[model samples]
Target: DTSRPTDLQRLIDGIIDDLIALEAPISGFFEDVDQLKRLRHSEANDYYQQVYGLEQRRQAYLSRLRTQFVTRLGIRTEQLMRENEQRRESIRRTTYGRVEDCIQWVRSRLEKLSAMEFVEDLEQLEGMFEEHKVDNHEIQDFRQNVDESIARQ
Candidate 1:
């Protein structure tokens, strides 16, 4: 079997992928003291420092990522705001049209009613006192009391 040179790129890719995918108690593998402790042996102390530097780079990348996320969010919010304004105007037009239609229907129906018929319909209100359980005699007494009080004033 032929021996191949060490795949440094593959090792770096695997490490970066692991750092990105880390979660929970294993989060920030490069920053974790316990994980870095393994690389801090007398022979590899310099390597540990390099790993610490990589962690700082990851933090810088995270800052840039947040900026990009905010920019995209602002653009989407502006687009949605414009869309909502258009929708509001459309709803206002629809509501006005519906109100006008209702008014026309009511006017047409009222025009069909004769004055005598309308008067008869209004005269039915005379019975509402009993329907509402209100005594007409008590109302007359109250009205007389109010008239006397107003005269005194």
Candidate 2:
């Protein structure tokens, strides 16, 4: 007696009211599901197609982000290799020039490299390398010398 057709209508109405009170994204998801149910009609099908296209674009953007990260990592490694090459060239050029002038030239090159994201602790490295504290520059010099010497051999 209490469970009539009106009871079913009240239950449906309560569900609809709860769904309507959800946040925008949840509401949109539910709306899209509703539109899917109505897709036998023409307008609902068109709207669903548009949402599908937007989903595709969102996926493409995510894919592009992944590719870009890989490309940037490759570029960073390439930059490290090129830096080693240039350092060897610098050492060779420095050997033929005055020591003070060579140091200045190296300092200038290091200055240009100051903007690189690879250099996290600039002040600490500068103190370590420029002052011969930990043989940092000497290690770099040795690496350059070895590469150049091996190339000639």
Q: Give the candidate number with the greatest lDDT.
A: 2
Compare the candidates by TM-score and give the number of the best one: 1
TM-score of 1: 0.27
Ten-residue region with minimum lDDT total, candidate 1: 1-10
Deviation in angstroms for 50 in model 1? 64
Candidate 1 off by > 4 Å: 1-77, 115-153
Per-residue lDDT tens digits for candidate 1, residues 1-153, read 132223533443355345444322222442354344434434243543455466446544533433454343332345435634654564465446545654565565456433323235554766553533444443343343344334322
Q: How far is candidate 1 from the true structure (C-alpha RMSD, Å)?
A: 30.6
Query: Against the unseen true structure, what C-alpha lDDT does each candidate score?
Result: 0.43, 0.48
Per-candidate count of clashing residue pairs (backbone under 3 Å): 0, 0
User: What is candidate 2's lDDT per residue for 1-153, written digit by digit as tens?
Assistant: 255545644554455344334324543753674455434344554564465455445434433433454343332346435634664575465444434444565686687567544456889768646655434544454454344334333
List of clashing residue pairs for candidate 2: none
Least lDDT summed over 10 consecutive residues: which range in candidate 2?
A: 144-153
